[model samples]
Target: MKEKKWLRTVLSFASECRMKMILSVICAMISVAGGIVPYIGVYQVIILFLDGKPMTNGIVFRASILFWAFICLAGYITKLVFYAISTMLAHFSAYSILENMRNRMADRLMKAPLGTVLDQPVGKLKSVIVDRVETIELPLAHLIPEGISNLLLPIGVFAYLMFIDWRMALAAVVTVPVSAVMMAFGMRTFNKKYAEYMESSNYVNSVIVEYVEGIEVIKAFNQSTTSYEKFQKAIASFKDYTLHWFRSTWKLMNFNGAVLPSTLLGTMPMGMVLYINGSLSVAELTMCLILSLGIVAPLTSFTVFVNDVKAIEYAVKDADDFLNLKELENQSEQITLHRFDIEFDNVSFSYDADKADSPNYKENSALCDVNLKLSQGTFAALVGPSGSGKSTVARLIARFWDVGRGKIKIGGVNIKKLPLAQLADMVSFVTQDNFLFNCSLMENIRLGNPKASDEEVIKAAKAACCDEFIRNLDNGYNTTAGEAGGKLSGGEKQRIAIARAILKNAPIVILDEATAFTDPENEDKLQKSIASLTKGKTLLVIAHRLSTIKNADRIIVMEKGRIAKTGTHKELLKGCSLYKDMWEAHIGAKQWAAGSEKGAVKQYA
Candidate 1:
């Protein structure tokens, strides 16, 4: 994952497009050869003019001049053609790799433990999907091909130089190694700084996204100073990092820019003095001078390519980390459900053990040795205190995370044996924070089933009580939801989420406080819709308000990652101490709400 890996990886990609790559190399050679020969042609014309007689006969001199002219003309034309092909190859390869990468990353996210994604900040995940992957284009497409072409030019020039005069060639060769050593030293510093720079950019992006998303909350709290301070901090950090990088990079550039070309510059005067002192002939001097200039393009190109190769190496290292991440092992099998019933058998899990460096958390079990069975076509409620693992139970039922011990079975089949897509089709969940795309309402709703008909979408909307609000809007179903549906009320967005779940028609539905945001007026309709949808389907509801689960077929009360009690509402109220206490507290709140001047308490269940 260090710098320099990029060139090796990119070369692998180029190797796949072997023919185009070979053609590019050939074009580079032809272009360099033509450019170098012009000086020799000029030198020959000068000798003829000075001596007032040609070295060869008139026809032969004319033919030689024509031959050089043809070399220059053909070289220029071939260079353009080869460069075009090289660019196209790079473009095609980059775009192809990017396209596949995006698709694979999306698939990985889909299969990733849902709780893992929930735990991460939305802005950070957004940065990964949109910014991090997009940044790879530059090094992959432009740097790889151009870098190789530049490398070849230098090697070609050196070979031609050695052929003409080894002593002067040795002078040029010796200077390159020295310049390379200096460039390498500079690169070491630049690489570390560049890594820091990229990290700062990602942080700034995350902060900016958070600021924009929470603008309303900031304004409502009258926290403009706090918000501005955050923005100022992020921007200042980014600026400092960028400035440091530029300053360091400028020094590196100065060294590389000066040292490479200075090799030929220093060699030129010495070669000319040798010719004048009769140690070399005029033709030989002409060849040396001409070839030295020829070496300039390739030699300078080699230096630039060195830097580019290092950059690409770092990029490849990053990409390899992404590619090396382990996907679910048994992901390809088709999903099979013998029955919709779900069972958790002595399952135990702890998040800390798996992480490389456990963050701030005491050794608390997320789930203990819990056993439960959820029969098909029944409405079951999981009631618990905040850390009682009710959400963990729901997540396990959906196979969001594999159990640390024992097994989770859908019907009689282990969830691990099921195909991911098939498992997805069998279950639907509407979480507390409903996510919506920045797209038209219709499009967002259609995510439940991309090929769903407009009629089906309208039907689903009606089922979730979303049709009225949607119709009242000026754009109707065409209205944009804004980012994550920020433009809509929480209730409106939740109903849309429910509508999506309904449209999906999965056999099992998990609601993580689905009605928490709904007002009383909409609550009745939504509750009835949910009840109707649960008919002959497995339903698991997580609730804070006891009233919401009063009518559920069964309720399980959980405490400290273990089940406290399980029974009907009346049974729990009579037999379970914790349940009775929770119910009493809830009843007290309801009475207090009835007595209050503000009217009915806005209870969230």
Candidate 2:
């Protein structure tokens, strides 16, 4: 029943290339038939000798021998031709199936919820897509063609042996039951061991990726030894688990290996006894030896594929788990709104819902019944310390995650009812840690608007103050960003991201510390670019630097996921104590920076 299930899974994956697989199977069957013909010819020659025919006709006897030799040669050549054709077809089908599976997985991931996608680690996803999926190729390509031929050829040979002498056929299979017992014992804990091995492998992959990504942090914090300890431990654990698994199966596997191929061990002795007792003929015993040898080779080959079957089962399960993730719910019908005003109506949320035991989990909420509205064309700035839910509010408005309670409306319609594409077109969000793909600078910006012309992209770049540095680069806008825009500075990457948002030209914009990386020298120029880009649009800006948002129409002060105060900068300074303390701190930081610069300049002089 378990073997049937494995076969069913294999067939399901092959459904797309079923015709090719069937053709391959047919060719394999032909190859198996041809492969057995040579042995059959050898049996015929032995039978002729034992018949006690007169040898005075020596010419006829030699002619008969040459005829059998030609038959054997033709059979072998046919086997070779069909085997080659079958393998080629199987490989083509396997690669096609892999391509289709990968494309479907990628499409499903795009539609899945952002939170669900983010919850998965990069290494885990890479393992499933690259490593796990590749494992399926071996079973699909070789197992179908070679495995089928191996199984059927042995059955055919066994039937021929039965025809020669039924007792000898039964005797030949005496070692099979004993070998099967050894194989069963070896496989008893195979599933458990494989699961542990997969877990250990995933852990090693995760730790290696994390270590490489955090190498700079490790150096800066003087934690090289400590960070490497975790990496070493993970790798050591994987090696130990792998070695333990192999050791546990070693004895049984060796026993099965030694016993399975020794089919003639019982056959030769049993046939000799039967012949001595005058129950078996010499010709029949000779035929039994040749047929028994043929049977063992195919049976051994079949058993080897049992391990490949288990690997495919596990890999398919992992791929299915990832492909089955839930996607976000949104209406298919697009709805055009009357205005771009945003409203948070009694909103509450928690990032910890998926992480019950996390140290950062909060029972209170990330946003507790927050109520606020931004009128169309108004500039709203959110100011608060870390963990105050400022970023959460921005993400909620952009629908990166659904609110835990209450509805967030855009133009008086629940955001959930809006088509995802339409809602995406309505807002532009520029996050602090923006990602840039490994491509030319122009191509990266074109991601925001694939249809935009080069001139339009250059214009947006100029608006975001990215044109100057981009032009100064060796290839101007054509310069590659490298991986994650590693070729550019933090401030430069931030500008490129802003240029993308500007090109989007949405009516509503959310900036979550978008200008935090900019130097003081470029701050004024970036603010001007932002004002130009956001003209006549509703803008929500989250900033820790209070001086940056002083000209806002309204300043919202958040504390512990709740709104503490909402007013203009001057109004908050006089009436809101929290806002006043934050402003004082901001002023002190600016003065300290000015003093440090003066000291550095005097020291240099």
Candidate 3:
């Protein structure tokens, strides 16, 4: 049953190319049958014609020549038809399966635990989703059906040989066991090497991706030499590993190549003995030669296919392992929320190692003694330096990761109890580094609320201060953002992300440094937009710029993953030393910049 289930995973994609599948199979059968006719029929005709003396002349001679020519012609036609159909089906099946798999992988990313997805390198995940999944296509579309077809040919050859003479049949069957043992030994060595080669390939891919993506930073920091050295070292290591693997498998491949022909040496000499002993006729001897010779090509092809299958073992295992990860449970339950009052009650949380690579942390202590409450329709800001766990707070509110210690409640219910889809609908997040899909500007904005109308999109874009800039572009909203909106300026991308958040219009909003990289000119407009947008929503903003959230109803100052201070921004500015220091620095910088500008103008005059 398990094996059947496994087969279904590979071939469930058959629905995509059912017509071609049926046609390919039919053509293959015709081609194999035609192959047998030429192998046996031509030899029989020659022997019969030569043996006749008085009867074989004129019409008989011409008829025999025509018959052989027709058989050869039919063989080539069937073979061509079979090959064309099989290749077409393979291409169609592979492309369709890859498209579906890529979408499935993307959906998996959305549903996977935040820690799980984030822990993986961008390159590693790219390899799995794009590269590894692609590798399965060849094995699926060609290897599977071809492997089954090859087995059938071997079976047919054995049966035909036996029917002609039981002794020859037994002789052919006896050779199979020896061949099987040699094939098995070869396969074992090849499998080990194949696995090692695949692993090294993934590592090499990761290094190449990282190096290329970081080229700009490396040059800016004068680390290009070091980065190149690291990249070269990784590539060299992979090359060495591949060479070692090839050395191990070379012997196996050579042995398999030689094994089938070696069986012929035994069969041909033995057939001569049978003929001399009056146990075999000339016809029988000729048939054995034809059939046994046909065996070598298919045997070699089958061995090559087997090796290809073994080579993909790692890719299959990697795909299966990724699929086997425990996704968030109860993701489909029905949930309804009228009010959004987020409550974190003694809610200590830690990155689960099963899902992430975390520091050596004591159990249940990412955030200790953490108690906070955000009332419905209020704006709250979390303020801290980097790694003070501010972003983690926003993540927990978003339910990206379940709280480890205490309950996180939304509308008086545990967040874990809420359906993931429902939770997603109820909350909207604008992350620090806003990710925009490589699509039309309109489509990227509509991603937040697919049901939203074009008018609604324009309205949201205006409220997020993005409409004016979008209109300035030649194609306006139709322009493609390119990968991660790399084509757009940083401020433009940030505003577009804000437009998405506006379109979502969820009861709860989490903004982690949404305006961190914007210029002052746009920042003012964005601040006004955010204030107007969150008037009736429960807002939790991870504040990178203190000036952006001075009007927040409450501010929680975090230190070392704990809430060091909590109050209104004004109160904290007066009472909290850390808050006071942060505010002073910000204010002093603004004043000093103004003074410097005045100084520079006076000196120029």
**Lowest summed lDDT window (length 10), candidate 1:** 596-605
lDDT of 3 by residue, 1-605 (tens): 13235445545645766676677667666656655666555665766666773274767766766877687678767666776676667667667866766776677777778888888777778777778778777876776457656766767777788777767766654556677787777666564566677677877887899899999999999999999999999999998887877687677667666666565665677788899999888878788767777666666687667655654555555655555555776555676776789998887777864422344443335676688999998788899877788989888887887776788889988888988888888888887688889999999999989999999999999988888888988899999999989988787888788789889888888888877776656666666567555657888888666766777778899987899999977799788999889888877776765332111101000
**Where is the poorest 10-residue window by lDDT in model 2?**
596-605
Q: What TM-scores do the predictions have?
A: 0.85, 0.88, 0.87
Residue pairs whose backbone atoms clash in candidate 2: none
TM-score of 3: 0.87
Task: In model 2, state the lDDT of residue 450.
Answer: 92
Q: What's the true lDDT of residue 105 in model 1?
A: 62
User: Where is model 3 poorest over a 10-residue stretch in terms of lDDT?
Assistant: 596-605
Q: Which number leads on lDDT? A: 2
List the candidates ranked by TM-score, beginning with the highest. 2, 3, 1
Mind giving the per-residue lDDT tens digits that candidate 1 earns over 483-598? 88999988889889988988899999898888778776667767755755565778889988778888778899999888889998999999999999998988888777633222
Candidate 2 runs further than 4 Å off: 1-15, 45-70, 221-234, 273-284, 354-362, 594-605
Segments of candidate 1 deviating more than 4 angstroms: 2-67, 171-174, 184-256, 277-279, 301-307, 316-321, 353-363, 592-605
Comparing 2 and 3 on TM-score, the stronger one: 2
